[model samples]
Target: MLRPFLMFASLAFFAFSAPVQTPPPSGAPAAAPAPAVPADAAQTPNPVKPTAESQARAKQIYGYDCALCHGEKGDGKGDVAADMKTPMGDFTSSATLKSMTDGELYYVILKGKGQMPPEEGRAKPAEIWNLVIYLRSMSKQ
Candidate 1:
């Protein structure tokens, strides 16, 4: 009798202890939220000067983290990008980044856009700035 009671108690405790998540009423997800870009994002300037060493570090980071979706050449043709419905922007094209400022890029990198998760904690602020510079160079090349 005691063993049976303990089993029932354990079962009740587990059933209540687990988290409960209800499905949405619509049974579908809402649209993706707009990235949190500041009004001054366009005015933000790149504080990190592009040096060979900084660019190299950015390259290493990009290769490991971003190359899966952003391509090795910044051409938006990474392996994962082929599976995505929305195409990644081509950094090799000057027109692709002509309107965006350094700050805007920084915000996108730090906060994330669409399916791209925020790169926060993966790199320092200065390294992100270096990534922006590295991306800009892709168009020039």
Candidate 2:
């Protein structure tokens, strides 16, 4: 009788101890906007010119770090983009590029946004400026 009682108690304890799975809320709050970039940071211009050599180096760096999500051509159609919850922006679009300043792009690259991880330490300041130049060129293509 005691054995049967202990088994029932154990079963009850296990059932209650198991984590309860709940579905996501039907109406979630809207996501907060990205934090504002500092005035000094935003105003800092890209000292690196968009030269052929700089672009070549930028292309190599972009392929290794950004191509996974931004696509080889910067069209926002990279292989991993399909799996991402948020859609990637097409750098090839003039409308998209027109609104963003070089400094803003640099800030985003350094700090990251949403699903993108920060590239601050991964690339030097000069390299990041080169990336900004490369990104600007994408809109012209």
Candidate 1 weakest ten by summed lDDT: 23-32
lDDT of 1 by residue, 7-27 (tens): 999999999999998875755
Q: Determine the backbone clash count of candidate 1.
A: 0
Candidate 1 collision pairs: none
Taken over the whole model, the C-alpha lDDT of each candidate is 0.86, 0.84
Model 2 weakest 10-residue run by lDDT: 23-32
Where is model 2 more than 4 Å wrong at Cα? Answer: 1-33
lDDT of 2 at 25: 66
Judged by TM-score, which candidate is best? 1
- Tens digit of per-residue lDDT, candidate 2, span 1-141: 999999999999999999996654634434445757888888888887677887899999999899889989999988878665447889999887787788889998888876677788999988899999898889898
Cα lDDT, model 2, residue 111? 84
Clashing pairs in 2: none
